[model samples]
Target: MTPPRNVHARAALLMLGSTLGFGLMAIFIRLASKDIPTWEVAFFRNAFGFLSLLPMLALPALRQPRPAAAFAASVRTDQLPRYVIRTAIGIASMFCGFWAIAHLPLAQAISLAYSSPIFVTIAAILMLGERVRARRWTAVALGFVGVLVIVRPWSHAFSLGSLVAVAAAVLSALVAIQIKQLSQTDKADTIVFWTYALWVPMSLLPSLFVWRWPAGIEWLWLAATGLMGTVGQLLWTRALKLGDVSALTPISFMQLPVVTLAGWLLFGESVDGATLLGAGIILGSTFYIAHREAKLAREQRSKAPSEAVEPGS
Candidate 1:
């Protein structure tokens, strides 16, 4: 059955809020990073995000063991090795992401962040041994062109900030691939819990090297980082459950503009033409790639006619 119209509307609204939450979370990360070490900011974000996930554990049915699955449905997962690998890379990505937010122009940083999917496509082909066609190859090429447009490492256009953001994107793409591997065996909640749980300890070790107390309202900024990150994820999860991924994914790009506006109004940062043009090019390419993937998935489903995968599963 088709989702009700109201359901679609609600999904749109939820996705909108989710984007806003994350956009603001980036702002908060920048604010918090002004006074705190990047690693420390990441740790507190993980620490508080994990705290917010506690209420989810209270849902009785979520923890039930799946007989066929290798892992249970609770906070614990049997995928220790996988979790360890993912956590390490994810923390590195978070560190880069937060640092970029603090150092780069918000628009430029956000633009570079969207380059993850381009890297994802490359990683999928190399690591997953997946075959690719000319269309996706072309899209990936175009995506790289867009990245170069933004990075402009040779001239005054992009430098360390762009490089850091790109590193974050690359690491993030690797994490995405790892998550795909884990999702083949573990439940989403178990993966999420383990991610944040493992991140707290993993992220803490490095943070100690640069740790200092949060001065004044810096504590509030840190708190907002955790809270908004968690809220955005929760809202995003719900929105995806209620709407089509193809319909919702584009709404996420709204985050760039929201964050850019915040950067201007709050920090007096001005965005330049290269960033916007580069961002548009990158977005267009990634959007096409996503559209193709979704279409291919739909075609596969039509061919096999299996039971529909449950939301978030």
Candidate 2:
């Protein structure tokens, strides 16, 4: 079925914006890495990102009589344990991801990072006890083939950097599942607040070991990393809400090209045939998996009673 033209256009634009934001984020991370440790970069990113959300949290207060209390109420949550778990997994992913971007070819790191959905499929089956048929299993297998193509451990193409990128994807998949559970009980705002609130300190420990004040433009790059990441994330969430996952998932791959171009232009990085091929394979496999999931979901919704369900829920 065709989505409404205007709706799909809006979603496409949002996804493109998100792609640019994230591409710039990788660029900024590399720039910051020249002078600052990746761990400190993570710490500053969280601290600035957490601060960036204050105005957003305050928006809710404007609607209520007691602004201060309303703001406090918005931030209050009973889900500290869940937030801690989620933040731990997320911080680990963040660390691994930063390390990869700082250490690996930008295209390779970003391409492997995109394999999170593959891991999510397996994680869902294992952790959530969700049933999957042979088809998704095949798609998942194909996704691994893409990973191997990129890594190619038998050849010089392989390195710990490649493996670290894949590990980041794996932890990211777990974070996705954890967020799914938390979303059931926590408002999106509450979850966002605590994740960053806790991430600030969680990422701080390792950072202190290497802490040196960011000098001159190192400060600018560090701050831009936080802004770009946060804005990209918000746009990504918005785009998914507006468009079909099957469609938006492919659009998100535009990030790879954006980063690939930036990597070559800014850092003089070279991309090889394997990285391009592996990235394409991963993109194809993921798009197919998303298409299949959407089709089955539609079929299931049709079979159930005639109650209103969210279009993309």
Runs in model 1 with CA error above 4 Å? 61-73, 305-313
Looking at model 1, the pairs that clash are none
Write model 2 residue lDDT over 1-313, tens digit each, in one string.
6678999999999998998888898889988998789899999989887777777777879889999898788878888888898999899999999999999999999999989988988888788777777788888889999999999999976797789999999999999999988888878778888898899999999899999998899989988998888888888888988888888888888889888888999899999999899998898888888897777677777866766443221
Q: Which candidate achieves the best TM-score against the true structure?
A: 2
Evaluate all candidate structures by whole-model CA lDDT and list the values in order. Answer: 0.86, 0.87
lDDT string for model 1 (1-313, tens) is: 7778999999999999999999989999999988799999999999988888766644555454653232333555678988999999999999999999999999988888998988998898788876678888888899898889888877865577779999999999999999889988887787887888799999999999999989889989998999899999989989988987778879989999999999999999998888888999899888888777777766667766566432110
Candidate 1, overall lDDT? 0.86
Give the Å shift of residue 67 in candidate 2: 1.7
**Ten-residue segment with the worst summed lDDT in candidate 1?**
304-313
Model 2 alpha-carbon drift over 4 Å, by segment? 1-3, 305-313
